[model samples]
Target chain A: MSELEQRGVPEETRTEIMEATFRAVSEHGYAGLRMRDIGEEMEKTRQIIHYHYDGKYDLLANFLEYIIEQYEGSVEVERDVPPCEELDIRIRQCLFGPGFEEFDHWERMKVYHELFTHAQNDERHREIFDEHHRRLRDSITQVVAEGIERGDFRDTDPERTAQLITDVIHAARERKLSLGHDDAPEEAVQAIDEFVVDSLIVDE
Target chain B: MSELEQRGVPEETRTEIMEATFRAVSEHGYAGLRMRDIGEEMEKTRQIIHYHYDGKYDLLANFLEYIIEQYEGSVEVERDVPPCEELDIRIRQCLFGPGFEEFDHWERMKVYHELFTHAQNDERHREIFDEHHRRLRDSITQVVAEGIERGDFRDTDPERTAQLITDVIHAARERKLSLGHDDAPEEAVQAIDEFVVDSLIVDE
Candidate 1:
């Protein structure tokens, strides 16, 4: 019975390993990362990894939690729907809002790719993903439905319209990340401005 | 002259290493993969990798080339401006044409992440990413501009509008990947479908 016994893979120790694993996986990815590498990066030992987490899978679940936490904490998560009329505005407000005013697309892009790749093959991973980017799509769909009810949006399918909005948002993030370079400027951001307005505000 | 001192790495041998690296990297990812694994996968020796490619960078370049050949080669690279009407159709045709039709999003998604992350610190890497995607974005903008001039699309800012289109497409791909395990049936794809028709089809 020593420090290892005291620690004995407690929640705190598990969380620390998972957090470090997140960085390693995000920077390197799932395939190349080694137990020793994680230990070295965090200045711990491989036994610590074994002690706190059963193995890679245990560490993966916890790493996924961190990935999803960032998502819910992102500009997209919603607790309650906004008025149908103002959902678009809310979306843009959060996207380019002062809260994320200091956000850097490049730094976040790798973590996104890491989590997203897992989301494809891992069920728990996808839950974490949808948990984050939830409601924006539904809200958009509801907006379309509401518009139809209000006799504003077109008579087309609301659900379909919602998916497109989701698509647009998803696609924009990819382009934004891939296209964001040191040389790229504000003009890049300006280019996609008002996309939501155009997509949804049916021609009068 | 030994293997290194020989005339050069034979093109077939070089191509083999590239092909082997492509398979290895795709399965294990750039960081997770190893030179030894690439050799074993290809049924050759580690020396074969050294003979054909300098190291990881060289393997990555060749892998990138394979991606371009396998993936980019499929895209209809139209450099010239098509007629306005044709251009509009082309935009819809490529993006809305298929959600999962042309390429499996998983492999392409990984390749995308690979190039994008590598581009963070490497100018040449960014250059490759910039060249392919910017061309596609520019193409969409040109179409929007033409539609505006000829009065096909609405009188909106073509530059900004085109970016929005690009963004939505980007977002849609992400949603497809991110929603990999959503309990929702193809509802997400349906939403994107309607959005395309709404976004591109002009009001009569």
Candidate 2:
């Protein structure tokens, strides 16, 4: 059972609170975030939010976990989807999907990046952020390994190649976050399609 | 005259203050940074530091400018260094350089990342961070253009290739900042050297 389940929080209530936290982060950029602000966004009293969370840190930590769960759920491959296509879809979601343009999605990603940067100094933040990286990178690595086993890709180091693809997608997102204008999923797709995926193509 | 020069601050005094800012940022990260802490680091009063900078934001804005200047100075190619080799060296410096391992350098970078995350919501921070990206990308673009002009590289789009390389270096740094365990610049260097630089190499 998940933390929310163990705490007896209904999934609907948990999601509403998460959305409220998202709004708070969007307005304040994490550094300026306050539990009261989140509570206000949710149309609830701070005490009500406090009942659900230890404080801002605990709420945000669970928010990170919630985000990972949502992402993992989104990227699950269907029976009909080829592993390579699935990988491409995941890259698109990360690099240039509506996530980059939709204000809510963009803000959520920005908050995520903020958390990653903060993790450099804080151990607890590092642990939470690292889990996200491990899950995402491991998922990509598994896809690449499967592709190689299916003879769709050359015998390259699956782990390193996955990391390279992961790095590129992240770099693209970071660029968008920092510079505020970039070729969206197109540049990212091209980079991955040409450099990463193409590099792994097996010769006939 | 430059901002520092117009202020009539002596070069020696400016360097000392910059070093103090670096130390303060290392200890506090940028979000927690206080003018008092920086002044204390320099063994001066807050008023003395204020005489040089308006406040925390102003001081850090100038500090960001100072860092970009330092980085630009470091990446300058020598007259005898080949353009391609010069580019490789720059990648090494950015991605896997001893700079990332040295405590002072690592902390400074962490602070820079913090500033960047803050910039997502702060206009002033965005301006400072954008200048760094523009200068760095422009520098990389120039090298790629030079390589193409000299026939050392194929007729690839220098601008896009430069951005690709820029993304790789940044992604590598972001990975290190988040994961805390990654191949020292070697992985980044290899990714660029093979995927980027090799792709641009002309056939004999």
Candidate 3:
């Protein structure tokens, strides 16, 4: 059982709070978000939220985890899928983001990056972001390694290639969200195809 | 004369205020920063700062411009340097950052990203970031165009190539600073060499 499960917070209640937190953050932003704001987005009162989490920081820390969990969980593919196809899906997902029913991907990413920037000041937040970064790079590396083994990709360092692709996807999202460069995501997809994906594939 | 010059704020005073703002933001962060905190970093009184600027947001808007100006200005190369050399220097400078006497690069970047993230809420800040992003990409695009023109690089869309390189550098720095992945910058350099720079060069 997870720590959250051990704490007696029901899975349904936790997901409700996470969704509320997302709505609140999307509306008020991280700096402006309040328990009251989150409560407004849900049927529960602020007291229940306060009872479960210590304060704003604690709740936000958990929300960050929840957000990462959602993204990580959403990166699904069939077992029969080719390594290159799986790699492409994962890369595009990272760059363009997964579609969420509650909020737009970039909207959630704005809040995510806000918390991400704040991670520099908070140890807990920093650890969470570190884990997220590690998982992202590792997942990509795994796909690249599979591709190499299957003779679909060149004999390159999987870890390094994954890092490059991951960083570009990250940077592209930041460019789009922060700088309002509407074309950054599309441009990044094309660039990845030409530079990264093409370079990784073995010549017939 | 520039708008700053026309505003009657002396160059020396503007630079002093910008430096103090940097130090203050570094200490307290963007969300926590105050005019008083900025005042403490300066030899001049708070009233003097108030006399020159309206409030925290106004001062910060100008400060954002000033930070971009410092970075844009610092990206200098000798007149006769080759396009590839210039591109390499610029890329390394973006990923690793330029040296500054008063503060560390990553430390300052933490503060910069904080503001960049906040740009979403403020139109003025968003415009400033947009212009900075454009300039960074354009300068790189120009270099890539020159390289292709001289047959140093393979024929490719300079704008697209530059966007990819610039985004990776930005992401790598953010990864290093926010996630505390200390090796991110170095790993990015290696990735760029293998994926981007290698792909761009023409084979004899």
Candidate 4:
């Protein structure tokens, strides 16, 4: 937070504005958000954000840098996923947990999807998406690789397996969004969990 | 083919328009398409198409209905899998082969992706996407259920398995898009196909 502010605004102000920015961007999408709205929410002048970060582009860049930095810093891979007999269950939970059943998850996906659409035409947005995946795959691969070595998983190709698990979660989210409206059918999370778990675990 | 043109222009004319529509819509997306371009390509007046049907709206509707009909009518169930030693390899190819190589797959994906994006606002587009899944899933599920009965597959829940496989492909397409431009990376296709195959098959 200090680093982000030093790069632009004061630490507290930047962090507070960023919280409002994420909340606004996540809910209303990039198109619907306005600097005045964020200022009003945070009880700060729009000029403050502008003076600190240059403009919207700088704000977007700093916001992503801050978020990705925090994402990387907080994900203590070795500590987060402790291993045991319920290894498969833990892996499944980590990937497709009901924890992601939060409303924030859905809105977050919508925001990301909107950016993905724009990324087709904008190089900067595409870079963000690419960086997100590269970091995610690397981090997950480390845990899955370690799990296999510690006898928690089958001696399968960890890189391949990590990508597979990643794709499964990605697919499930798409399914939720596609069928997410009023008339769309609900899918059982446990069934999908089994499908993911059984697909990856050792036959023993 | 015969069924679609029973009410339209000469069968050849209708077929020509539909094929061009698919190529155009699939390549440039539905919103990117123009009725006049389709008319010019067919070398026919809008009046001709209007006389045959209603207009561009009718033409696109008939085209979608036609694809749906063709999908249901002529789906190959792959009965020849025939208890082989290399069952997983064959099954993998069956799920994601032929139409999904580096060729028009991007274009195909583009149209569906466009529909997915617009479906956020358009109920009609969402219905078309859901129906596409329903018919495709029904055909695939029937094949899977029969395989389970025959002791080929592990007697897993057929509908769920169908959903998972479709979801995998859907996600892989998205991941690949996020990673590369135009054609999916060769590595992505191989990785996706191998992961999907590995998950679906029983060891011989």
Q: List, residue by residue over B31-99, the lDDT tens digit for candidate 3.
A: 867789999999877687888898888899999988888788888778878888888888888766789
Global lDDT of model 4: 0.57
lDDT of 3 by residue, A43-117 (tens): 877688888998988888888988888788888878979988998888888877778886878888888888888
DockQ of predictions, in order shown: 0.39, 0.65, 0.84, 0.30
Number of the top TM-score candidate: 3
Candidate 3 vs candidate 4: the DockQ winner is: 3
DockQ of model 2, rounded to 2 decimals: 0.65
Backbone-clash count (model 3): 0
**How much is the lDDT of residue A14 in candidate 4?**
76
Better of 1 and 3 by DockQ: 3
Q: Write the per-residue lDDT of candidate 1 for residues B1-204, one digit (tens) a residue.
A: 323226476767766776677567667666556777788778667787776677877667656655544444444535554434455455554444323443454556555555655554456666667776676667777777776776666666766665555555545545555575332224433442344324555678
Q: List where candidate 2 sits over 4 angstroms from the true fold.
A: A97-103, B97-103
Q: TM-score of the B chain in model 2?
A: 0.90
Residue B198 of model 3, lDDT score: 89
* All candidates: TM-score: 0.68, 0.91, 0.96, 0.69
Model 3 per-residue lDDT at A35: 84
Interface root-mean-square deviation (Å) of every model: 4.1, 1.5, 1.1, 3.4
Candidate 1's TM-score reads 0.68
Q: Which ten residues in a row have the lowest lDDT in candidate 1 chain A?
A: A183-192
Off by over 4 Å in 1: A1-52, A70-90, A93-109, A120-123, A130-136, A139-156, A181-195, A202-204, B1-17, B41-49, B69-72, B77-114, B117-123, B181-204
Q: In order, what lDDT does every prediction score? A: 0.56, 0.75, 0.86, 0.57
lDDT of 4 at A65: 60
